[model samples]
Target: MAEITLFAAPGSCSRVATIVLEEIGVPFTYELVRFMKGFHKSPAYKAVNPKGKVPALIVDGEALTENVAILSYLAATYPDGRVLPAASTPMAAARIIADLCFCSATLHPLVTRYCMSVKIGGEEGAAAVKAVGAEAMKENAALIDQRLCEGDWWYGDAWSAMDAYLYWVFGRFNGAGYDLSPYPRWQTHAARMEARPAVQRALAHDEAAQATLSAERMQMGPGGAPKAA
Candidate 1:
């Protein structure tokens, strides 16, 4: 068995990977990367993941970054279809892969640009970007809601890591003060995800790490920079 260690930050996109790890029931060490505590920028963490991002899965001391890559790995390594659904063909495998890309490459950046638009761009630019984000979010939510309405999960009857990733991205929109009531179906799906034992466990891991960050007085500032703890 490979010794695994996950360097994760609480409540970030890393939550998706954390959920899958719990779903796989794997034995791995959780190394909290306190982003606000300046650990992510630390030399030690950079040694682990040069990108200095959270949710870097270290397997036998080798690093794997990105939610899509990490999820794909857990699926391939565990081969239990817990991280993802077992595909009979390459095309079937690509289905979920495409969805992951949509969430990570597409929606993820939109939410960040939307939520942090004011910070990223000036007030005038913020208005322009916010409108774009709103429109894009609505279009994506409609597609997601339509698909989710067909099945209990994204694939229409099976729960996969994609669900976790969707929950994270969609919830980020909601968290950013965008109304999700229009997509009641995905909202319900989000609630269902929240009720999962595995999800709860992952959230627990997140909360514990956040509590530590809070105690250390290293909460991120208004501009996303770490404040002195």
Candidate 2:
């Protein structure tokens, strides 16, 4: 078994974990869990994580779930990786954790609600639910854009895991057809993130993995039925 095995779904929040792992330059294995094919819900994957979520990390034969927990673990285990601020006091650490919490608790959920409004609110009310979520997301984005105007990175002069988390959130919103042009600061921040070699590498890997999974699904046909010749 590899020292680390990250079970992830391409294009999901798992990209943040994969990017961090790449940034750390650690030797590990990546197990792709194709969300498109419902692999994440399969019994096999449920054995790894009963919650059926992506971004589960297996470290030292133990399973770690949740992005915040996994990120904290990586930071603690590899201090040199500099995934978070090197806080000298407890309050300082709390501040960093608070930033991460805001992303996970506030930003992520708002975007997800907007993206999955149909599922959350039923077909008849999906549009209204999505509108509410979109409005909330716009407010949150404006706040973040203002904060980003203060500096290049979220914490000013330092790029941390929070940046990765925020980047993922922004990417999700963008894909959902949210208008991001008004947030110039965020646009710049995203550009810088994309320029990172680690981020680029993770994105490339995710693209390849997603493409391969799509091909496999096609070959298997719908509901695992073989395609006509």
Best-performing candidate as measured by TM-score: 2
RMSD of every candidate to native, in Å, equals: 4.1, 2.7
> Which runs in model 1 stand beyond 4 Å of their true positions?
122-124, 218-227
TM-score on alpha carbons, each prediction: 0.90, 0.92
Write model 2 residue lDDT over 1-229, tens digit each, in one string: 3499999877788988998998888977889887766888999888888999988999878899889889999999889998998989999999888888898788877876888888888999999988988888878889889999778888888888888998999898888888899999998999999999999988887898888786775686678887642
What's model 1's lDDT at 158? 85
**lDDT scores of the candidates, listed in order:** 0.86, 0.86
lDDT of 1: 0.86
**Tens digit per residue, CA lDDT, model 1, 8-38:** 8877888898889888888888788877567
Per-residue lDDT, model 2, residue 126, is 91
